[model samples]
Target: MENGVKKQDQLTPPPVPRVAVVLFVLKGKSVLLGRRRSSVGDSTFALPGGHLEFGESFEECAARELKEETGLDIGKREYLTVTNNVFVEAPKPSHYVTIFLRGVLVDPDQVPQNLEPEKCYGWDWYDWDDLPNPLFWPLEKMVRSGFSPFPTE
Candidate 1:
């Protein structure tokens, strides 16, 4: 409420859900992930991606975020799935429609670095069957739904 006016009466629209792109950078049975240090999923492991910018394609967003956060490049991305993430327990409640994309590293030998230390702990390759504890809510939901981002033999 502003100046004794109720929030609903403010003449301003409510917040809108945002679209976030999460990448599943695959190499064999492993995927690239990092521990997020942000508002929504602090201390939780999550995929390497970010919000979908205006006028940017999903593939473009995936590659750009990968480079920005992990210092690695990707190739041949395809849509894996999407998750409806509502951070109801967060300090600032927020929602996001998370688009998951799967891609292979442009150079499998290239290691991912923690380009944004303030936002993430570090990047590492986690095997599908052996992912770390306390995964970001959306990601945990994705895994629990039996959605395997890995390519089948």
Candidate 2:
């Protein structure tokens, strides 16, 4: 019944991909680091993290990934940093919106057992002052810049 004018449908926006990293702190000196299983790429060291799901919050994703990857449960989490970076890997344009969460370890003495052996080799705790250089790029920057996941009081 319209005068030859087609109704335009509203275009829905594309979904944005997100990721969260849990910086597990123990004894106020050391932080947890995991070695990404070599097959993923050349990256050896990276913070515990992964992509966010359709309806999960950043905190939930961080906690879940931390536990799945390192067998660690983060009791309390605080925001550290938010980074939006474009990572270029041929055939895939990865746009990463990453949230860094400072987490507290429930049991410091418990050793983390990797559930996904094919993706993660092992885990280690390193002092803040003596972190290894081979860590993932943005993570290296975050450490060198002295960015604490916890807020300073």
Candidate 3:
């Protein structure tokens, strides 16, 4: 105890690395994306996702986020590659260890709806060959790394 105070170990530890679980709901030759309107990655296209909750698995986080953000429920959560994203140029610098997830919609007719207008502008399907510009940094990284959610028939 220096200066009449306890050692640093007496204090609480820092938070863990931020983890974002994203779901890629694949359709025929296209995947779903939402136009973001939030502070971190505003005006860019992003997949449905959110921060991983404590004591939750990746698949549970993905399914929960999808339902909360887009009002679409998905099953058969398949683990995909993860990306380490650091956004240094944003108004608020941030980092995320993004866990990618793939799932087909349980109902083919169940399309995405904008459940959180405050965070998302809208949702749409984008073909991999023609993705929207200014993609979310993690997604851009994923594309640049030659990752695809589509399965070869």
TM-score of 2: 0.77
Candidate 1: 10-residue stretch with minimal lDDT: 7-16
- lDDT tens readout by residue for model 3, 52-120: 999999999999999998888897998978888777787866778999989988897897889899999
**What is each predicted model's overall lDDT from 0 to 1?**
0.90, 0.71, 0.87
What are the root-mean-square deviations of the candidates from the true structure over C-alphas? 2.4, 6.3, 3.8
Please identify model 1 stretches exceeding 4 Å from their true place.
1-13
Checking candidate 2 for backbone clashes, the offending pairs are none
The sequence of per-residue lDDT tens digits that candidate 2 reaches over residues 15-71 is 455464545455477777877765333455878888888798878888889888878
Instruction: Give the candidate number with the greatest lDDT.
Output: 1
lDDT of 1: 0.90
Ranking by TM-score: 1, 3, 2
Give the lowest summed-lDDT range of ten residues in model 3. 8-17
